[model samples]
Target: MKATHQPPTTGDTTPADLLRGAALYIERHGWNQGAFFQLPTRHRLAPACAMGALRIAATGTTDSIILDDVFTQVLAAQAILANHLEPDYDHTTDLEADLNFEVISDWNDDGDRTAAEVVTALRDAADTWDRLHPTGGENA
Candidate 1:
């Protein structure tokens, strides 16, 4: 008989899970995720507070991620990292120290694997970062 040691489950914070979370947000809000979130666009993901949602709709922004109205920028940051480990940054000079984060990077050719694998890797990375930076998501 072969001795099989199963890898411990991350218990749900994987990137695949995070991407599903993004979908959930869309479903919950009854908005089309494809229409709002453009894969190739480099738009900033600013979470909409209850009041912020009003402003987001009022302003003409084409490419933006519309998440739950309650999530804050802090949560969005964590979510984006967890869902897509290698995410878009407004600029290249951003540093972990400045954001009080430890640098973690994941690279994959877009067609090399399934989206699930990519998302799971990112989820693991973001979870690791969150463990280090435990100051976020309380109210976000």
Candidate 2:
């Protein structure tokens, strides 16, 4: 399945949607360890990793700076996903804790990491987002 990056405003695509869509993307495209995306062509998108999926799901582009805005909107959700990747993650002092990018990168780059695990992390993150905002508010 190819990911179509629709603007969030068009269909009530919440932050949770971004997380879930990313998981689904990874499930379909498999995973890549060393890069954010793979097989880039003018025709389709193939997100290669967890963060890459998130970026594609959120903005449909590879410019990573956009991720800062994405993370700011879904911080706790990110934290939940990060904890799944690295159980010992200490958000308090971690250099990139709020975004959880460091832990995610380390986890994905690990030789033992699997695509299923990354997909699970994204789904769990979406679940956490739902629980935190039961009314579908974007406050978190």
Candidate 3:
């Protein structure tokens, strides 16, 4: 089957949507965004973008997200689309391009929303979920 590519900005407007989309993309690409020690310039492990997130989670630097864990990164990404997180996406890679799609930005444009903003938004949404006790009901 031909893999699906979601339209630009189709569902990823909110913070939750943005996070889920990013997480989904990372998961699909089999990327583990975490800290890696670049031996040539190593003081400690350095964080890589998506893999950095993973490394940080594995270590004690930051709290982890449900997305991209050893057992459930894939499912958590799907669940982020299905429930809890908002917006959602289909972040499949295209081998012809031989890279994950980059979220385009316009330097001439004026908006608070940048690629960094998108990542932040997603992380915030994930943090919010982490704050919530899933076992408790709505009042909790």
Q: Write down the lDDT that model 3 would get.
A: 0.32
What is the clash count of model 3? 11
My TM-score estimates for the predictions, one after another, are 0.30, 0.72, 0.31
For each candidate, the alpha-carbon lDDT, in order, equals 0.33, 0.67, 0.32
**Predicted model with the maximum TM-score:** 2
Tens-place lDDT digits, model 1, residues 13-76:
3322333343333233322211223232234343322122222322223224443432233233
Which one is best on lDDT?
A: 2
**How high a TM-score does candidate 2 get?**
0.72
List pairs with backbone clashes in candidate 1.
15-119, 15-120, 15-123, 16-119, 16-120
Clashes of each: 5, 0, 11
Local error of candidate 3 at residue 121 (angstroms): 2.7
Q: Residue pairs in steric clash, candidate 2?
A: none
Question: Sorted on TM-score, highest at the top, how do the candidates line up?
Answer: 2, 3, 1
